[model samples]
Target: MQQRFETIEQYLEWMGNNNFTNMTWDIEATGLLDETSIDYTASPYKIKPSYKHHCIVVEEHGGNILAFYDGPTYVFDGREYTERLPKASSMLHTEEVVTLKDYTPVEYIHLPLKEFKNYVLKRKIKRVVAHNMINFDLMSMKLVEDMDFTIGVEHRDGGLTTWSADTWMGKQVVFDDTLVISKTCNPDLFGGHSLDKLSRRAGGDTKIDFRKHLAPDVRFLDFAADMLYYCIYDVKANTAVWHWLQDHEDYQLSDRDNYIKNWLSPIQLEKKVAEIITYQEHRGFVLNVDLCEKAVKDLDAKMEERRARVEPVLPPRPATKKFMADYTPPKRQFKQNGEITSYLQKFIERIGAQLKEGDDRTMIFEGKEYKLPLPADVPLKTEMPAKIGDTTHIKQWLMGEFGWIPSEWKETDLTVDQKKIKLPMENIVAKIDRWLDVTYSTAYKEERLDGFGDYMKITPRSTRAYVRQRLIDRASKGSCKVLTNPSFTKGQEKEMCPDLERIAEQFPFAKDVIEYLTFKHRRSAILGGGMDWDEMEDGEEPEKGYLASIRQDGRIPTPADTCGAATSRMKHRKVANVPRITSLYGAELRELFGVGDGFFQIGYDFDSLEARKESAYCDQYDPTKEYCKSLMMEKPFDVHTMMAKRISEIIGRQFNRSPAKNVKYGLTK
Candidate 1:
């Protein structure tokens, strides 16, 4: 390893004063593979981390070699033994607390890890620092301090959570230096925000990549020095970044009260506000379970009525069971394959479209007066599961059978008996030979069979990736033009399919489906919170994902990710189950989080938050700024109606407001 860190004596001599605990630390430890795990080779997450016999390297500002570990001793196999960790005369270090028989003992003096707890208490170490201290290191060190010691995580910040434990040290703050780096700089410099990467930024290295050093055959003590060195090297790197933030940016690592008002810069002030917002979000909003349940149930009932209304316009599900039993998939066609040919071909032929030269793959299907190409988009997928009325099956059947062009429809989650289901992507698994990667795919099946199950299942495609949009575009070929195809992005709010919306303009059935889908999506939101954790009947497991994410105080915490290392754009994290309460569509859903008995909730929304932000940047917040004139408040002129009026002039037909609205938004299509 590279010797990039200052020696123990050299660092202590130069230790400087800083508020919020100048004590930065890091640890390296051995973890036990769970007994249930079939003999190692498991994923890193599966390893049951005990952090046994570890290296906990601490660096404090007002340093005196910890002021406690000087007389520290080690306990092995229940009896006490003196530590023999190889370090400078001033530092007491030991990587393992194993018996003499287990470890290779050398003639050296070290301290017992048992002294760690006492050291913290004696020195009154209220706050400590480490990169990713919340998840791994803090828990491990606490165990060594006292095997049964517990640490409470104050807030879970994805991997960047902050933890605290009320020790004799008076509730020490295990500060994550990673968070400091994230808020202070642009992440392009060091993208992952990992300790190793951060060390590199400080003209240093992580002395040892502990992950690579711990070979299965190697004993824990085999690389003790390397682990200790790594921790020491990292603490210096961690402290260096903290010191830099203090000196250069004039930022405080401590709480809000300690921050100097005069020292705050615009960005720093924003970060300070972000910190408070993060804390507020951590506190979470109150949830009225009864109110939410009633509203969600109302949405479901409304959807059910709409489903009943949509049913009359829909065709019967294709008899996939009969097709599965009687018909065989096509023999892999020359240079291609059509496994679904026979079943869907019947519909194409029924439309009076003759096959082109006995080729089922290429034939124009006539719709009213227009003719469209057969298989206009995408090559044949190797396999289509022979399931009747599967989402893909129903959608394809609708487009093919009716010669219908879709418009303005949003993709709604399909459930089998009210639960989302996924089938194994069996064909891909069969082509394992073509895929060079075997680590996540075809690893020894019997050895890690359970892990393999995870790979076999396909993540069901959202409608944006589904085939219906292409069909909609192809069908719009004769006289009609496709508005846009459906699309889905993770953070964006717009979900309407313009193609579906435009198609629905002429087709009554399409409009019904669009409305049905909108309500269906709202209804689906309730399923994730079908049950609450508070209602668990004694020892009963309330089916996975069914339980509500409510807190003891009946609140649903939507943890905010205020400032990322790469971007300062704030977002509510882990909100997969929580619908966007701030949205106009979710107005009713938003009210479920009541103002409680005493307070009145005065709610308001920005006219165009992003647009206004940009306008602010250029000092053009004028309402007359043409781009800001339409759709977004400031008189509420409809961009959609204007587009529809222009479209009507071109097409020579009266256009309605509903489909036009979808066309203007759902721009993703």
Candidate 2:
């Protein structure tokens, strides 16, 4: 402790002398990490540079600590750090520290990174430990230091909400995050993976509510000491927690020393996995920005053109969206005008007049055959998508399919096409035999979909049962599809959503909507731009595809979560595959990356997560895990709070608070 580390060499030498095998580490940073970004080069660019890692503090078992900072060094004694400290969230621990009304400065030695290359090249730092190694710390090391790692499971020990594992193995390192382990491990034993929580639980100097004094563009020199203080304390806090975990021998993945010893191979694989994820997310893919922007514009225009034509004669429909203010965590039930049951019933019957019941046919999922009812021949004026798993297929086939083409199929151009090779009928009776052994199936809309429910796996003959159920759902509700199984944020969470695909089977509008959603997907994903509630509130036209997610360093961060524990199917996952969030995107919404720093902010109403989980769809969801419990027993708003929280953050609105005028006003816009 008496010897100081002004350079990485001195620290490494000191660590070697003490025979320290691993180092517990931490860091502090500033800026919009991901999702949102700042462009300093714009015309009249008044934006300040933010979004960067500040320091890396490493602590060895011998109580020796070293810190690396690219910022200026500061000299000082003890000064006031402030009395009115920001209230600590459950995740942060600051209740034990005393402060003054202002920030007190302290002297700190800066360790130059000059020797970092040698440290890594020579593998001098044989092992590294830190909280959130996968998400932040390790990721930072890879990006800034070019240090590669063999990523492992987010170390989770079933106890100490913060102790990832109730017992931290002395030889192991804490890298990944609490998030992955919480859901992947036994949910009951999982506490939480938070620095402060762990520090407090570990009975040590906890994490500082650094944000209390944190300000825009002033974190560097102005609050250098404090920022550095926070950095060092995190390392200490993490160290204490690690020791505490080490002291307690709780459950272990094996009989060996620790998780690392038992599964060293798997543990090492984690860093490599993290590396690949970082590559796609931080370094990111070179987007065809121009091509993407054009897709968004052209598709959006086409959707509008189609909607305009269908609006006039379309049957009176139920008001869409069961709840309102989709961007706010708290929800308000939307006023749904009564459904025109009579009119809908009559029209649907009118079209069904020509369709008779056909023989039952068989289809397979995972080699299991299901004999379903097939509708008899129904005249098709034009070929389009189909609506499956519905009681009104025959009618929807005619009306919902051609409702846009003729506006009113019965009154206007109901005239049949003369393309029947054999029969002298008018239009080709699209042998509404979607359930029968009909050859005209849109099930193969995809070439080979392995994730989720083997999309289009039934046959080259029938409509998808699950996708149809979701579309029929979209007709009454909005975009919410259904929860695939579980595996959302918390272990209990799950949602299902697929914008437009199989529905292109029976619905003509599906074509336009599908194309539109695809472009919108690319705009948000590849172009690094998406419209949120605030932009809509400002009446600012939605992002026509801006380079918003791109950072000053020029990369889009699209972090991926590893979900091998929940579903061995996806070794690399992004966003934890939350149905509330993932379901609404295109299945191809993979690998849209630009790296900076950001994480999915989780928010949810625990009461009725079950109900909402059954209301979404994920392309990568496992259908075998689907659960449907009392769907009737659910709140209109509880299911979508997580989704609402994400939109709130993206739009720069604090909608997660008790209630918000930001959300209320945006609803109108």
Candidate 3:
């Protein structure tokens, strides 16, 4: 007959009497120091280990018996003795308090760290399951020099849903994680893969709130009783969720079917992705600090030189003037004072004489009898002309009266020697135009460099601040307050400031700058842009590196979803979560990604991958027909040329003319 233990104490006593090793485990670390205060960048290995408050192990099947262990002090055969806590720190840290109102701690004989390790080694433990066991619990245990026992058991992680049981130095151990298991079962599960959430979703009543007891810095001995209970509860909850998932018939059936079809279950695929990501993270990417610093310095010098050249041409701040209130067109009273009232009235009278009675004569001012005059030459009354609808006639009248000639408007003939006519505030307007062009261009260059510099030594967060400052500086140059406003749009700039578009057309730099900014702002499905860096380590050398994060769908992506493709056919060809180095245009910029010592970069891609796939699919759907046989057989077939020829044949015309010439003629006709 087998003996059944009701409590953890009884279980420990049974373990002492007879060997029982296969178990699920969890550990609670109490009184951890704040990592923010530690200088990990300067000396990562020097950081002190966090104190472990309790370690709980529950048997996989032996009546679900649990064994609890605590540290800083342990009692052996009724004798109390001191012991050091495990060196590995818990990944999850909190400052929450532990509640003990209704909880009771089980009393059992304690084994010192050495004895505890020996007892487990002698039992020849077959499996050890825990959430985040690899990076935390087992990692901490491995740091103990005296406890050099081979982890011969299957080590499992419930958080990341990954496992490794490969032997190190002739030791064989199995590892697995439950995170991917739960995620694959239900991707849309409300709460994430946290132990508390999983247990609740599995209909278990166990709730171990780590935040309910000790402060992050509190000693483990002070809260040993409560910590032990909390640790045990976590193990029980984790095991319960695992069991629930295994017992679910629907989940088992679906998982089995998927495994049979794909040769790997969804969870297994996710595990593979996780493994890749872990390896990449461990092999951190390199940074070219010197090159980045030099680039930024050079950019700053160029910006200053550009600023000096443009500042002289920028418009001085307009004088703050006051004037008497005046009437506008249609005889409406002007609420605001201005100097243009007399000029506006004269313009209105001239328009009235050209107006016809039957023509559409809407008042410019609401509730006013004054009607806008229409040109006598107006050919049609059915459609409103641009001159009338857009109020361009008033603008023409003003230009004629003030002798103001638009800088961009040119005569139809190329032989005409244009006269430079100046009008009221013409110099100021020209200066503002110049200012806008230079400032916008400067802002664009600065933003590009600032974004790219983050990959070097500069932090992305700080670089973002610098980008904002550049915009603010540009806005301060003139009355360009719109540039600083959050809601400002490029289209609005043309409307609010009439000269912006004209300047953009006249100055190639201005047009290029705006176009470049627009291109950078547009969202794309592929990944490209500045790189992100982890904290700098002491003695770490600059080198080329890569980063990736695996999703549940087995695709890797950066935070922006910039990478990660779903198709297996092209997955190996596409480099996800990294910049497209081959497509980068500038030679100087491309040189930054040169392979470092001991590392070699290589590139290979399928030819016409999408076209090939389409062809294959078409053939598969209809075996009797060869839809793409001729094209497939033709080596190095130019699809673009083939399509262009087909289009010309269908249209019954040859497209032998330049696109620009075609467009010019098309528009003229």
Candidate 4:
């Protein structure tokens, strides 16, 4: 049996078999396909045929796939083709294998100058294809001298070879049917179309090589305005051809228009061509640079002209105001004080202030008496104030609500207890400018505020500053949690806190406090600041009176009581809802007034079809009366008339002009 097995092994060995099919892996090969010695070489790439469950081996020479070895010679599932190999080899003969070949036909023609001239001299060939070749032939020959083997070539006629342009350029086409030459060709106006770019040449260098113009990422913004130039070359043969690019009329608009339109500029088009040239480095496809320059110049000129025509011209201003001698205030009528009172309340609220009730109809604010309704939350007190040393404005007092100082509040009027809360603006101006450490880090740790156990070395200012900066940066950057789906509810905010926590870590100082304060604490705090009608109407009018001072210099109202009232409301807002408070006035208290630019304007008209259709803004202070009637009714105290009359008196004193006549309407134009 040993002698018989040895004879069988010798017979199998002579069969020229090495197992390409394996026991360790699927699919191995035996030596039989070498051109030099019939030694089978393994394929460089594994191939997956559409129907086959196993990967086949494919071989290539010079980037061209030549052949693939068929499978079933190797079974992947625990079956050893190596062990079954001798039996499998019994089915194959040497004649069954076939060699693969490159099938792409060479289309370009190339020849030495002598051969090219001779061919021209003989005039045997009926036609020749060249793109602007009359002048570019010599340039093409120079390029070939530098990139010899890199240029793909195939020998067709004896001593003459054709090269495939597609092989080097990937795939390119010259569109000619859709070419147009109008102002529209000036790229800026009609871009983001099917055609990449359509530009015209005016006066400039005509020697621009166009292959240089192809961008790595094609930026054909205006299909109609850009010129898509494609060139095919067989440089050694001194031959080249070009196609005039045009738009495909039937091409559809895509969602990517916005992204691509910006790249359609004349300058961008020139850069794009250069980009393409860089991408195809080994292939010496130099575009016509002179033509590109010409196109750019022409585009610039056209753009200038378009601008000149469309540029707006301001009409000369009238030398004098146009007025009719008979002109009168439009149908003066008494406006109901009810809407005016509500409007005043809303307006004051909009300014971050509220109305407080007083004795005998006086507005009580910070223990002071005022003729106007003071902000509801302001404390009612009357006492001498704490002293501010060596100050230009004795009335100014530093308040403790985040860089907020009531400019109108007399520092002397603040009691000694209140004086402690006053932060000196001048003394700390430099420190504030330098961003000094105001946060009580060590103290906060000592106090052991809830959720701050991790803070050992961290300072209060450092943590608060970090949180403040994070909030500031987030607001400045307009960062917002994307509420992607309607199903997302408030419950998910706690879950979302982890997401904010990650963001906070990226920004030092935010810790988790900033995130908690903004997302969770904002709305609830604002609700707490809502008007407390009971407090405002509770107190009685006083002997001494205070009225809102109208500024004669066209400045916004700056009543001291109003300022005090605003500070109180802001304090409540901060305590109740920091996020909503920040939203209304930004992170810093000073920025709310300072950044908003002193003027306070709020519009609350309840007209319009949306209001009528949905009754969106409809909410009854009193619902028994008709909506229009209730809206138009005056306040029982005639607040509007009284306020307007007082304001008119102030204006007359300053400008010697009466106030504009008040007007009323029936909720229609």
Top TM-score prediction, candidate number = 1
Candidate 4 has a TM-score of: 0.14
- How much is the lDDT of residue 425 in candidate 3? 42
lDDT of 2 at 510: 41
Backbone clash count for every predicted candidate, in the order shown = 11, 49, 12, 70
Worst 10 residues of 3 by lDDT: 410-419
lDDT per model vs. reference: 0.42, 0.40, 0.38, 0.24
lDDT digits (tens) for residues 1-669 of candidate 1: 111112333332344422344587665554431222111233222223433446555666545322112222332222323333332211324253222233322222233445555445444455566665433454445334432323333445687534344232345443434553444444323224556555565553343344342344234433334344445556767776555455444345343443323322333334344545543543456777777678667877776776666665554543444443333323332232534355446544444555555554554534322222223322222333422213333344445554443333222111101111211233222222222132123211122222112323322232222223332332233211211112211113434444444445444554445445445444444444322221222223322221255654555555554444233455444343334655334677656665457878776767656544544454465556544444443422545556677667876875645566545554522
Per-residue lDDT tens digits of candidate 2, residues 1-669? 123456556655654753435667766655333433334335322323434556667676555556666644544345544422232211244342334335444334456645544544433343466766666655455444555554433444575222232112222333534333322332222223466756776687677775454344333322245566777777777777666555544535334557645444454454456446655565443333455455557646754674554443334322224211121111211124633234333433443322123521332323444232212222211222322211123223333453322111010111112110122122212221221222123221321111113332333233555444433333233221121111101111211112223333544444433233334444443343343211121113343233554445444444565433322223332222222435334333432322224744235557544344543433135454322222223332332344345567876753332223234333422
Instruction: Compose the digit string of candidate 4's lDDT tens values, residues 1-669.
Output: 001112323323443643321000011112111121111122321211211111111111011111112211211222222122222223432122211122212221112222322222222222222222211221232232221112222235886534332111222211111111111232212221112222222111122232233332221111110011111111111110011221222221122363134312321233223223322221211223333344335434544443343222211221212221111112211134422254444434443433454333343334544554334433222222221111111111111112222111101111111212223333333333222232232221222222122322333344555544433333233221111011111221222222333433332222222232232222222222322111111122211100111112211221111011212211221111222232422233222222124745452435433324323244444365344343343543232344445555764632111111122121321
Tens digits of per-residue lDDT, candidate 3, 1-669, equal: 223334434445665655444556665554332232212233232234434434544445454434445343322222322222222123234333333444433333333333445444444455455655543454445443233323222234665333344342234543344554555555434335567778887786355774333345444534444455566677777767766776676575236554445323444455445445433432333434455345445544544554444334322321112110112233432324532244444644544423234543443432344444323322212222221111122223323343322322111111111111112244434444543353344322232232223223323234444544443443344222212111111121211123334443433233222222222211111123232111111122222222122222222322211012211211221122333443222333333333447988665777756556656766766565444553354432343334445546765754322222223233322
* Model 1 CA RMSD to the hidden true structure, in angstroms: 17.1
Ranked by TM-score, the better of candidates 2 and 3 is 3
lDDT of 1 at 503: 49
Best of the two (1, 2) by lDDT: 1
Worst 10 residues of 4 by lDDT: 224-233
Candidate 4 lDDT: 0.24
